[model samples]
Target: MDSLKDVTLRPWPAPKKEELSQEDLLVKIEQLASERGHLRDITEKSLQEDIDAGKHIPDDTNDAVKQEAKEKEAPSRQERLEKVFNAGKEMYGHLEWAKFAATNALDLLSLVLSQDTNKRNLSTFSQTFREQGLNQGIPFGSFGISKENHEFHNRKPEELQRIQELEHKQKVVAQGARMEALDSAVDEILQAAKQLEKEVRRQTKYWQEIVAVSDQGWPLQRLRQNARHVPFGVRYGLPEAGDHFKARGFAPLQMDKDGSIILDPALALKPKTFRVRVSIDGKITGTSQLEVEVDTKDHSIQKSIQLARDSLFEEELYHEMSLETRQLLAYGVEFRDSVISVDAPLMGSTSHDRKLLIDCIPREDIVADSHHHEHDWLARNVAEALRLLLAHEHSMRLYRRSQSPPPLTARTQEQAPPPLLRTLLAVFRHLEGVDSLYVCLEMVANTLNSAGLEVTLDTTRETSWAILAESLKEPSKRGLSATDQLLEIFRKPFDGRATLTLPTSNGVQFESLTIVTRTIIGQPTFGTEHKLTLPSSLTSDLHLFQQLKFSSVKEVTSYLDWILPLHIAHRLLKSEYSSRATIKSHDSGITISSRECKRGSAFSTDIKVELLEGKLKATALTASPLSETEHTEQSHTWNGGHSSTSFKQVIQNWVG
Candidate 1:
């Protein structure tokens, strides 16, 4: 709690000096004058070259005669030096008074310090004299004033030391006070910052709640929750918006439980004329004046009321409203005429208009989701409905504002929309048709661009379908009907059945089928014929096979690496066959052979697969037909193919 006023110390007083005799003073003055004169001489000499340069005038007249005349008029070097000396003498005389004044001031200061009682003053005076005396060539040490005499005139050493100790203590106290004040200030600042942070967080949370309500649309419970949290100053006190409805030429008596605004039957019995104004928030947005004649027995007014209400609160219609319209709805709705006025905020508006219509109608009404058949029509029309709802709400707000009493002061111009409202409207315009499939396709195109794929939706779709059509078994047909046919395009060769076409050495094409079979009753068996044909020159070239295309080699090697172990394990576990499968790759071909023993009936299959002129060739040795047991096993394996598991394993291995 130390105050800033307590942090300052008293200022030190000026020192006194000893008096000098008149003769000595005069001598000192003369010596100082001589020293100043010498200094003046040095300064003048330093500026001599500049002074000479300034005096020189260049000759412009024709050479010989003009040069000779200029030389005669100019002063000689010796004469110029004499003129400079004379000028220096005049300037020295002018400065002599100033020099004398400075000398006398120093003498006066020394005299005052000599008699000063303050020790600090006396010491400062002595130090100043010592420094200046050395600089000016004056004998301050020879002044004949002893330290003892000087000390006796001022404070004693012990007294001066005590004064110094007291001053030090005061300084320490002042510094401590200053530090305490600074600490207190910093603490206050921190507390203020913390309070400011809390206020910011509270405001942020409040705004977040408002935004959530606006975005989600206000349900009854949510509206109530919002009301509870709203500051008292901003809370609207009118009955919920759902309690009222507006119709031309009819005054609403009450709202039914189903949300229809029931008009007075008496008023509706005869011809009547009325004007209606609707407002949302505090602004008038719409007005209608009408004349109506209805039969009391027919309940035509109620029917008209229900129809008007239905048009106002339709869900499909609501979705099509623009941001400006939605903002109006948010402000609430108002209905007014000469005899009656009603106001309803949008927060309490409900989607029960259809139910209300049905309750008031004579016959049952069928409610449909949408009137449009095309998917795009529904999307586009839904947006239009929202815009309409917003526009109606805005009209209601305007009508309400117009009905209120005029203020004492009038505004020169209408207020512009708030910045938040303007921003929301801009966003709505930007995403106007976002629900349409075309817009969705555009969004997808943007996604593809973001992911480093340079593709547009139309181009991508066309290319994909073209590729699919080409791969189909019935390429002539325009439609793909089977799921398996679509899935076949993505299938790989390792799933146990692969049909490969290869050209023979004579240039004729042949087909080879590789089939793997496994069954519960017997060992798994794999059979394939690989026909390998190499060009005559490359028949002995082993390097060609070793340096095959990396991707193709990897596919073949991986398939073998995974399938060989599974085949061996299945044979060993069933105890029906002890099989040895050998796979070797050479320059001309890849050779695969499997020898198995099942119930002492031995069988062997050898396949040679080769790469010849960038085409795969497979050759298989002729083998006997499979017996009943083999056929049943093959059929069971084919029926329960492990496509999904094999595909997953292949993907995992490739990724690793």
Candidate 2:
């Protein structure tokens, strides 16, 4: 079995006249003509059979009508048929004459070929042609027939001439008969073709509808371009816009199914001031009122005020430029003092941090006309512009920072970041969760870039500290501590940098966690070449002390002894405001105290813990005052804070 996929077929040859060469073509034509004659004879026989069966015959191949027609026109049709037969008889006579000529010519050729002398007789042949009504009353050759053969054969010249004339007459009659038959056939075919053409024209409309053709037959693509016209549809016009519409311009448009031409609003004239208008079905049906504006450009401040005269409308611009102006500013150009200011109505109780606009215009008279120099105009305008720019920049940065997630939302609905804060929050959501310190820092910088604030951080220091802080707060969150994990992820570059000091609300947190780590000689070791510290504690009041030094790692565990006790003394003195007398301490401590009126609150607190020398001074501290009669002592205990980890550990946990 041959499947469709498995089947293969040979290519077919193109149709060509050479497929039936001229000689073979002639034979096919003769064969078809013979077959046509037989078909005609069979058709006539079929008509006779119908008549015999008493069935009606139709004219033009209708059997029933032809039968009736044959009966009604029987006699006249027979008479006409006989006349046609007589015409055929005449044509047959010409054929007979041609046959006679061929026979006689053959005999003459035989006689001429047998003759010993070059002379022929044509007189008898000429007499025969005259009797057949073929003589032209001229010499043989002059009549386009040759008698010279007879002369060459030594026959009587006149006889040969007569034969030549008869042959010429026969040839002419045969040719005429062929021409008449051909002419009749052509006329019949042309009449039939005319009828067929009429039928084709009648059916063409039906086909055209089926094909979805227009009158002129242009197809769909041409119509989309509005180039070709279709009936039963209106022609759409080119769009023209003016001040009455927004974004005034011209565009090409087409009518929708609703018969309304929807003009693109972007095509409206004077977009800054104009509103859109829609024209439908040869009538303007939309809101027709035009948005009018007094033309002005030099003073945007005045123009903006006039444009937004209503308080409600003006309030929309409370600290920002108009929507239209903002759109215009998007056209790629840098500005030194392009400020957007809004004067919003104050909303009390709600912080205005997120509120967008502020008072924009100059606080004082911008132009002191008569005496003011042009430079003064620029200075005042530029200065006001600069101030606005700086203030907005500052607010924008703060707004940006507030946006960072996990964005703190107010527990009570009373507090929310201002509109700018919300906007910055939105921006920050996009900025947060960035893994790259550079990128996170860049986002921070970019958020403040437009403001006067300059942000600079040593990547080695600030980033490491932030990583360390995050690790301590949420160990499981960023998987910074895992087995061989930091090496598995990012290559740990050698960090020899020292701790950086960045300004904070509290003095400065060590920028590098390594500073504290190395100082404590923690498990995650800073190599010997790196700065290291000793671990020790002095008094019973402090729990721990970390030794610190430069890359010179040595056990100066003595520093812990000096530092811890002094810190403990300060903690103890916080509650002794009543004592003004000086007390001497056993270990190089000079304490000055004044008992001034004994005017401090009296409370009794106690702490109990021991401090061993270079091992661990897990101490606890609690303030105590001389209570009334020194009777009761309240106790307090303390625990140490969480410790730090290395950068490699941080990355391992984070990556994992």
**TM-score result, candidate 1:** 0.16
What is candidate 2's lDDT per residue for 457-493, written digit by digit as tens? 3434323334654545545423333422321111222
TM-scores, all candidates, are 0.16, 0.16
Residues 299-381 of candidate 1: C-alpha lDDT, one tens digit per residue: 53334444333333432222222212333432221112212222222321343211000001111232233322223332233
Cand. 2 Cα-lDDT:
0.34
Alpha-carbon local distance difference test for all models: 0.35, 0.34
| Candidate 1 segments whose C-alpha is farther than 4 A from its true place | 1-161, 164-168, 171-179, 182-190, 213-656
lDDT of candidate 2 at residue 230, scale 0 to 100 = 24
Candidate 2 matches the true fold with a TM-score of 0.16
Regions of model 2 farther than 4 Å from truth? 1-263, 269-355, 358-656
